[model samples]
Target: MNRPHDPAPGASPAPRATDWIGTPVTADLLRGALDLERTEHGVLPHRLPARARAQCADGQLAMAEAQPSGVRLVFRTRAAAIELDTLRTKMAYQGAPPRPDGVYDLLVDGSLAGQASVTGGNVLMVDMTTGTAETRPGPVGTVRFTGLPDRVKDVEIWLPHNEITQLVALRTDAPVEAVPPGGRRVWLHHGSSISHGSDAASPTTTWPALAASLGDAELINLGLGGSALLDPFTARALRDTPADLVSVKIGINLVNTDLMRLRAFTPAVHGFLDTVREGHPTTPLLVVSPIHCPIHEDTPGPSAPDFSNLGAGKLQFRAAGDPAERAAGKLTLGVIREELSRIVKQRAADDPHLHYLDGLGLYGEADFAELPLPDQLHPDAATHRRIGARFAELAFGTGGAFAARPA
Candidate 1:
């Protein structure tokens, strides 16, 4: 493949549609998404079906589920050039530094081939203090990738994990068809912002995505940012989705959001696991506790943004709840990890396919000292890679929880 044709991320006039063939963005072409809702502008891919979305009016959950962490368009074609028209809605923190535009990753024949970012679409201005937001509409933009090999091959365009994207159209110089499944096991994962690819360089580089690539599994990522609080709707969605392997990374979001106390945490977890097993009985299911986060390790949350560096164009977070509150059953990461381990052990006796992974094993105190979380929450791009590599080894490697069994 030739060097990627990269234009800066910004608004540009779209190429005339008459020059290229247009393909409808349909469900068959989409992978890793549970539903596709038709909008006035285009079809928006959703990780959670409409029923699950209808049950929650929380804006955070709505945005996170629509961002499409692991969702991609996969097809077979000989097109030497491709253009995707998308209406992307990005978020901006009020009084804080502007976040980068989300990236669109292109893979040819299962390899990283090219990457691009769309410029203009929409922006959601958010006030961290007030928890309010305003939407500013912009023009739809196009992401173009050229100089692909002129031969029959598979192509995949992974959507940005942090942006709400609407597929306006797909244009190519040649015809395209859906790529049939290659029989790889499907790995479904659900977690918080870190697993949602918060600061990762691009979509395919997210830890869960990286682990899936290494494990040679198809990924369905439900890593909703700031919204993985063991919601019943989420568990129900998991229960209904089809998957050969499954994992749920729990704790950080619960602690940070202060969504529950010890009294509710145990039963919530059991219910979540029970729901998943209803659909995937005997399938390998792994339960992961929180990784090492110093701020929440001993202190309970209701985490708040630290605006001290706002003038310097940086944003950080602080655990606001008192450490003493743990005595009242308020949850902390330390408390969460212990409780999660106990819950899994108790259930595993009756569920042979169930397993537990201490998230500390993926990123422990030692790793933290070497590569601390940049914002005292989500991992940086380097840390994403590190965590992804370790997870692949421990979860998919020999004797691991998700290890392949003899047929």
Candidate 2:
């Protein structure tokens, strides 16, 4: 594993910078982040803030929040070349084979311009057998992009949605400045791994990212993998964040974690919405239930990993709880969907801006039959594109939940 110290075989040298100014990664230049925290190395973006993170010491939540899905470094620069150094914490299953490197996507003037990946970074070794994790420190890695248009233009370096990255340093051949806020509406979304771009091809390819692009909106994704459990802190975070459109994709995480039952679920949903409404009383708030997950559609969960394919370096998920538990108030996707629709309908009488979307509309049983989930859980790249396109049409198109109003 040699670090990428030099340019590729035929690549030209980066432009010489007599004055390479390093800008501090602050909240102003960061898009799609709800909060930022100072770390020992550098600034780390969080979907939830310090207060919210303090409430839950769950390792899963910590990891998910730090991953910075849909977050990017946005700035305007006239430089032809730009480089960013990041201290990434890459996860590795203790006994399983290593996974692929996370990708960094650079967009110029709102279009995909370049892409690259770093070499060395920290390793988070997770032992499945013992349920223990250890962090091994490693060298920081740099992602560099060269040969850009030599005119003043907007640049966005979208960090990997899957990796926990700490912004170590940024350098450019020319000076860079923050991009001013545009007239686009801000869309704030909260959900689970699917929304976090679990198996998406790249950072910008995530469903929410794609939807934001099609809707012509700014996106702040709070998609915490395996951690969207209707936590009060998360709701408060959403409540406080400024957004014109808000959405919370519920059910899948609740089902997979077996975190709550129907009895506690209704009130939790109400309370979460109540907190959000306190900040944006009239903002369009769309409640999205889980997509079609065959394993947990009618069955309760506490999903477990299927290790039968471990020898082949494949990990799959299966629902472990019984379907009969629904009678005891245990939750399932089907159960949660009904409850969510009922709750939204009851509240919409008093809160006209509130709405609900059955996630099955984005990825339903029929779609799943044609494009089966490879892991029996998360959707594949193609499915992500399909979902994103459908969501853009349903939620942001004309007369849709988040559609623009006529002047």
Best candidate per lDDT, number?
1
Could you tell me how far off, in angstroms, the CA of residue 387 lies in candidate 2 after the best superposition?
0.7
Q: What is the C-alpha RMSD of each candidate to the true structure, in Å?
A: 2.8, 1.9
Cα lDDT listed for each candidate: 0.91, 0.90
Clashing residue pairs found in predicted model 2 = none
In candidate 1, which residue ranges exceed 4 Å CA deviation?
A: 1-19
lDDT for model 2, on a 0 to 1 scale? Answer: 0.90
Which 10-residue window of candidate 2 scores lowest in summed lDDT?
Answer: 1-10
In Å, residue 26's CA in model 1 sits off its true spot by 0.4
Look at candidate 1 and tell me the lDDT of residue 334.
Answer: 94
Task: Give the alpha carbon lDDT tens digit for every residue of 282-391 in model 1.
Answer: 88999999999999999999889998897677788999999999999999999988998899899989998899999999999999999999889989999999999999
Give per-residue lDDT, candidate 1, residue 126: 94
